[model samples]
Target: MSEGKVANSNRAEQREQLSVAATATDGVQVLNPAGEIDHHTGDALRHALDVALTAHPRVVVDLGGVTFMDSSGINVLIAAHHALTQAGGWLRLAAPTDTVMRTLQIVGVDAVIDCHDTLRQALAD
Candidate 1:
């Protein structure tokens, strides 16, 4: 019974599918997150951003692979953007999908943070 419970727990953990790949190019930090971003997965994204911030101030978040997002993810991005700006850096967003772009638009994140159509554009700008 305990083994069955452990397996079920592992499966449940797997259901929270949000992964972040952090890297740096030139002087900017880039974070690529793939999967749904809800309350369950928001912390992972937040932690990744925080880690990236430690390396450099400017960050470009690649949202092309994100299929869905909720208020939690938005809040995280807002916090990261605020932190970056306060640190004399900025956060740019790259390649957000239609669903995620709609959410960002509704929240006016696009206005506050620069949103580019491509990663290359974001990196350049």
Candidate 2:
């Protein structure tokens, strides 16, 4: 299940440039979101994660394509992590861009969700 789609939030006048999509291969689910994941676009990410979780237990979110992320994005990830944890599953973030990685570190999100330098490394774990 590898597909892509652009989502528009309720911010009527302002169209969203953010895109959130997912792909599942070899028992690992990967979510790829581009552009900013702020209040307007966080819902898109949450929905994508929900779908991905339903299909795979071990989920790896590939953040290499993301340009920016705010607390809303972090909240989505945390929620996904909690859901997966409750289901005896897990979530990991892989290939985050420098900015995204720095944000995760500063917010202590990395402490909860493991961050890998590569998708392969995350899948291996």
Candidate 3:
């Protein structure tokens, strides 16, 4: 778990806010985000996605560690999805908590992007 942890040096002092790896799962880039994602921390997620996409367009954002999310996070995902799709790749969301899942559902992002109940399912698909 300690492996492939992308430092949060560019975003915040809390390094645990995001963990990223180009090939964390089946050669697919994975981003593990923790804590609440809001206006203040949304840029961190965005930056993480930017870095992830540079290595590979396909990415799976593991949201199991995320507790809360707002419009800012949704916008970040939408942008990342657009970028990946344009490159002939895709973005997948995995293991979102109930609250976060509800946020995605309410925003209709669940319909636009692929959402999975588990990280395994997301990567397997």
TM-scores for the candidates: 0.88, 0.84, 0.82
Q: Which candidate has the highest TM-score of all?
A: 1
Alpha-carbon RMSD, candidate 1: 3.4
Highest lDDT model number:
1
Shift of residue 96 alpha carbon in model 1, Å: 0.2
lDDT of 3 by residue, 19-77 (tens): 43335666689898888788878888899899888888789999998988899999999
Ranking by TM-score: 1, 2, 3
User: For each predicted model, how many residue pairs clash, with residues at least 3 apart or on different chains?
Assistant: 0, 0, 0
Candidate 2 lDDT at 108 equals 100
Query: Model 3 — TM-score against the truth?
Result: 0.82
How do the residues 1-125 of candidate 1 rate in per-residue lDDT, one tens digit apiece?
99999999987776678999988999999999998899999999999999988899999999998989999999999999999999999999999999999999999999999999999999997
Give the total clashing residue pairs for model 1: 0
Which digits, one per residue and each the tens of the lDDT, describe model 2 over residues 18-124?
78777787888888887788898888889888998888878899898888899999999999999999988999999999999999999999999999999889988
lDDT of 1 at 117: 96
Model 1 / residue 22 / CA error / Å: 0.9
Of candidates 2 and 1, the better by lDDT: 1
Query: Which regions in candidate 3 have their CA more than 4 angstroms from the true location?
Result: 1-23
